[model samples]
Target chain A: MEKNRNRVIIASIVIGIVLVVNILPFLWLVLTSLKTRLDIFAIPPKFIFDPTLKNYVSAFTKRDFLPMFYNSLIIAVSSTLLSLVVGTLGAYSLARFKIFGDKHISFWILSTRMFPPIVLVIPFFIMATQMGLHDSRFLMVIVYTTFNLPFVVWIMRSFFEDLPFDLEKAAMVDGYSRWDAFWKVALPLSAPGLFTTAILCFIFSWNEFLFANVLTAANAKTVPVGIRGLVTSRAIEWGEIAAVGTLQVLPVLIFTFAAQRYIIRGLTLGAVKG
Target chain B: MARVILQNAWKKYGKVEAVKGINLEIKDGEFVSLLGPSGCGKTSTLRMIAGLEAITSGEIYFDDQLVNNLDPGERNIAMAFESYALYPPMTVYENIAFPLHAAKLPETEIKERVGRIAEILELTDVLNKYPRGLSGGHQQRISLARALVRDADVYLLDEPISHLDTKMRNRMRAELKRIHSELQKTMIYVTHDQIEALAMADRIVVMNFGVIQQIGSPQEIYFQPQNLFTADFVGEPPMNFIDCRVKIGQGTLLISFDDSVFKLQNKEKVEKVANFENHEAQDFVLGVRPFYFGISKSITDSERETNFLRGEIFAVEPLGDSKIVHVKSGKNHLLVEADSRFMGQPDETIFLIPDAGHLHLFHKKTEEALF
Candidate 1:
């Protein structure tokens, strides 16, 4: 009993330190977002001060942050949905059928994700310019989908493989076609995995800055690009930057928390057999 | 209902032949069992019949129509998987109704069929519960209910109740037999349990090493096995095999093993042994089931003068209704099913009398039954 109590105390102390370390910066950012310009630059950082919404007001009015936010939402949502639809079908095919050279093909798909994004950015920039597709939300969506498709295929393939093959066979024997078996039985059973994959894809696309920075300009600027725009050469608008950063993190936070239950189960699903 | 026929059915999983060429005809409304040990290709044969697997090079016919190119759905079959593959997201009621819904039946009819099968399977109370949290037995019954709720040409059940407790398994066996009788649909049941095959199937197909060992009625399989594998695999306290040599002397044949000799008094058996005498191989296996052996505590002069063999008791297992006595004689060990009141001690002298009419003889080299 005594040893357990001491272990609990040590564990709680360690967890407390981890929580503070991770959350402290986000808390400070939110605080700075609500502060005056001078208060943001205050020495020692004021713990208690009257907060103002001027930074947020200027962010929406003068910075054209609303359109940028809309651009990010459109690109992220569209790209995530597109990747899921294509990746799920490919993953199920790989999981169920006897494809020739299946291991090599799957490895090739994963190898696409292994290439550093910076290496591809140059070629992508040239292609976008040559095709006159630069500075468009369509280009952004396509780029994000290409990058996220490999991850979706890899994760969803394992999820499909973990399912008992008998379910689909039973469904087919019960008057369902192969497609119907996959849609009605396999897809529904993998709901948790689908949600988990969707959230991760959405977050990856939402916070992406490098590809958006090179491929997008005035009309297609996402939240991250807009936040970078706040760092001007003459004087950095720290307050506005903090405001945009808080707003940028809000949607991802909501998405992750909403799918928190499925995320936990989906992440640890294949560790134990039912 | 349809008459299912397989003409030289074979299944090959890339170079490894899971089911060698097999031919069978299952009449409409007949309950046939494919019985074998694991990896004997019994399950693969059932899957091929269900159209969930493709035959390597053979023809399958349903009611005289070739169904080689048909899909599983097009074959109009219902199968209960060994894995109890109930949809995790659907409730028991929905799972049972899925096939009916796929058939485009009326909602009222779907509900009625699902409800009746669930009640019959004792799954009515768990109709609204998902499959993930149910017990294994409950999940298994739900799979059975789903398969039975549909109107299909054939019902393929692959070890549906193999995971249930003994009492439940017996009860399900009776229930399934009754259901087959009522529905009058061709059903192919697959199981590794010999008792299940014997108790339920009208005809049992015993398989070994991807080949059919024997196909016969339960009584024929029990009393008149055609091969050593069938005789050895079918019995509960399994048949004891004693290696013996056939010695023909003075127009009478005597079977000798170790220091014991017994007369082959049956005229037909004697003729069968005489036919094999020209092969230059005198070794044969004598098979006798436990129930066919009579145990005596002491050998009488008349008993010793006939078919009795001397042995010493190894152990005794009392099973409430009968006791199984393990006896060791020379180089052979045998089991005798004695009466419940019979008391025997280990290392005590015992004599086992073989019923001459029930003995089986198989060639030791060929493993084929001689009579």
Candidate 2:
């Protein structure tokens, strides 16, 4: 009994340290966002101070940050939804049917992301300019999809494989066409996987800045680009940058909050037999 | 109801033939079981009939209509899987109503059908529960109800009761037979258990190694097996096969084994075997079911004359209803099903009487019964 109590104390201490390590930066960001510019530059940082919404107002009114936020939302939601629809079908086919060289095909799809995204930025920029589609939300969605599709397919394929073929076969034998079987039986059972894949794809596309920075000048800038825009040659807007950082996490947080229940179930879906 | 027929149907997975050419005719409203050991292609054959698998080489017909190209849904069949395969997200009612919903039936009609089947399966109380919360037996009932709700032409059940406990399995077996008669659909069941096939099927097709060993009624398959495999496979303790030499002397056929001789009384039964071994002594095997042989503690005068086996009791296996006494004669161990009250200890000398009418002769080399 004594040993267990000691172990419990040690475990809680370790967990407390981890929680502080992770939450401290976010707490600092929130504090910085609310601080006045004069207070931000103070030699010793002030943990307790009068907070303000002035930085948020400046970010929205003076810097025109709403369009960037809107662009991130449209791009993330559109690319994630599109990737899921296409990837799920591809994944189900790869899981159930014996397509020739299918394993190699799926391997190639995942391998597309191995190279650094920097190598493709130049080519994407050149193509966008030639097509006259540069600095537009359309190009962002398309580029984001290119990176997110493979991940969606990779994640959803294992989910489909985890389901027993008997489920679909039973549906088919019960007077359902093969397509109906997939749509009704297999698809609904993969709800957890879909939510997980969608959240991951949305987060990746939401936070992406390298391609957004290189490809867009002003019109299709995302929040990450907008945050970088707070830094200028004349002066660095530290308060506005911190404010943007704080705002950038809201949509992702909402998306996750809406799907939080499925996330836990999704991770452990195949760990036990149904 | 429809009759399902497979004409030389086969299934090949790349280079391995899982099901060789199989021809079976399942009559309308008949219950036929495909019985075999695991890896013997019984499930493969059933899947082919259900259109879940494509026939590698032959054609399948449903009541005179060629159905080899029809999709499983178009074939209008219901199947109960061994894993149950109940939709986990749906409640029992919704799961049972799924097929009717897919058929675009009216909501009231779907509800009525689901309710009726659930009542029959005794699942009405738990109709709102998801599959994950139900016990194994209840989940199985829901699975069966889901398949039965639709008025399909045929029902295919693949080892549906193989996972249940013994008590539950016996109950389900009776329940299934009652349901089959009530529905009168052409049902093709698949199982690796001979007892299930014998108890439930109107006809049993025994298979082994991708080939059909025998196809017959339960009584015919039990009493008159055409080969050694069927004889050994269809019994609980299985039939006893004893090696012996056959001789015809003075117009009388006798089988000799380890200083024991049994005179063949049924001449026509042993005539073919006697004719096959003309002019020379030949090695043959005699097979008899344990139930047919009687054990005596002391050799009587009639047993000493002919058809008497003197051996020592090797082991006694007491089943609840009966006992199986293992007797060793020379190098062969024979099983004798005796009355439960017949007490005998191991290593006690005993005599086993082989009834000539129940004896079976097989050619040692070919393993084919000589009748």
Candidate 3:
């Protein structure tokens, strides 16, 4: 019992260290955003300074933060939804049928993710510019889909494979058509996997920087790109930057907590059965 | 209410042939069992009949109508998988009701049907519970109930109770037999268990290595097996075979095995042994069940019993109802089912009398029973 108690103490201390390491940056961001300009640059990094909402006011009023946040939301939601629809069908096909060259096709879809995003930014830039879609939110949604499709397919295919084929066969034997079996039986059982894949896809699309920076200019600039705009040549608005960073993290934090159960299941790739 | 027939049906998965040209005729309302060891194409045959698998050649007829091109739904067949493939997301009530709903039955009729089957299976209390929370036997009964809810032409059960505990399996076997009699539906059961096949089937189609070995009533398969596989596969503590040499003597044929000679008095038994003489080899195999072999404490009446084999008891297995005394004579071993009260020590000399009336003869090379 003493040994177990010591082990628990050691484990708790380790966990405390990890929690501090992860949460410290966000805490600092929040604290810095609330500091006045005089307190932000104080020599001792004032721990007991008076907090202010001046930075939030400047970020919203002077920098157009709300529009950029909206832009990020629309792109993330649209791309995640689109990828899920197309990817689920592709996954079901890969799981159920004996299509010719299916293995190669699945590998090919996954290989699209192997190339660094920076390499494709130029081609995408050229195409977007040529098509007059350079500053369009629709264009960003399309680009985000290209990145999320393979991930959704791979994850959902595993979920479908984890389901017993007999369920669908039994459904068919019980007077259902093939499509009905998929819609009613296979789809509902994969609810956990679907939620997990959707969250991951949304997170990736929400936090993406390289393409969002290169593709969007003024009208379609996402929050990540907008945060970089705060870094002007003359002077950096440290308070506003800190405020925007904290604000940018709010949705993701809320999303993680809201669907924490499914996120764990998704991260383990459905290896934890049910 | 359909008569199912398979004519020269075959299934091929790439280069591997799973079912090699099986032909069968199942009468209306008959409970036929497809019995075999694993990889014996029994499941393949059942799947083909259900239209879950495509036949590579020949035709399947349901009531004289060719159903080779039909899907499982179009063929009007219901199957209960061994895995108890209950829809995990649905309640027991919805899982059973899914088929009737798919067939677009009226709401009142669907409710009535699901309720009746659920009550019969004793799943009424847990009607709202998901299958994953149910016990294995309950899940199996729910699967059966789901299949039974529909008025399909035939019901195909693929080892539905093979995974249950021994006691539950026996109880479920009895329930299945009772259900078959009450419903009077055409059911095709696939299982590797011999006892299940013998207990429930009206007729059994025994298969091995992707071919149907024999189709016969349980009695025929038990007592009059047409082939060696059927004789060996059906019985518990299976039939013992002894190699014997044939000797033609004074208008009677004497079969000799390990210093034991038995005269074939019956004309049928004599003709079966005599027919083996047409082949060059005179060696033949004689098969006898353990129940037919008698065991005695000593050989006091040796002169009266000519069919007695001399051996020492190798081992004794005391079953609750009876005992199996294993006797070893020279190179051969025989199992004798004696009364439970009968006691014998290991290595004690025991006299075994092979009842000539129950002996079966087969050609040594062909393995085909002569009678």
* Model 2 error, position B351 (Å): 0.6
Writing each residue's lDDT as its tens digit, candidate 3 over B182-292 gives 889999999999999999999999999899989999988988888788888989889998998776566576777777777777776666666665633467888899999
On the 0 to 100 scale, the lDDT of residue B312 in model 3 is: 93
Candidate 3 recovers a fraction of native contacts equal to 0.77
Q: How high is the CA lDDT of each candidate model?
A: 0.90, 0.88, 0.88
Q: Model 2 off-target regions past 4 Å?
A: A265-272, B275-282
TM-score of decoy 2? 0.97
Return the TM-score for candidate 1, rounded to 2 decimals. 0.98
2 versus 3: better TM-score goes to: 2
Quick one: best lDDT, which candidate? Answer: 1
The digit string of per-residue lDDT tens for model 1 on B1-371 reads: 99999999999999999999999999998999999899999999999998888999899999999998899999999999888888877888898998898899999999888889988899999999877788889999999999999989999999999999999999999999999989989999999999999999999999998899999999999999999999999989999999988876665678888988889767777777778756335678889999999998887888878888889999999999999999999998899999999998899998899898888888888899987
Every model's DockQ? 0.62, 0.67, 0.55
What is the lDDT for A159 in model 1?
A: 89
Mind giving the per-residue lDDT tens digits that candidate 3 earns over A45-109? 88888889999999998879899999999999999999999999999999989999999999999
Candidate 1, B347: how far from true, in Å? 1.0
Please report the candidate that would top DockQ against the real structure. Answer: 2
DockQ of candidate 1 relative to the true structure: 0.62
Clashing pairs in 2: none
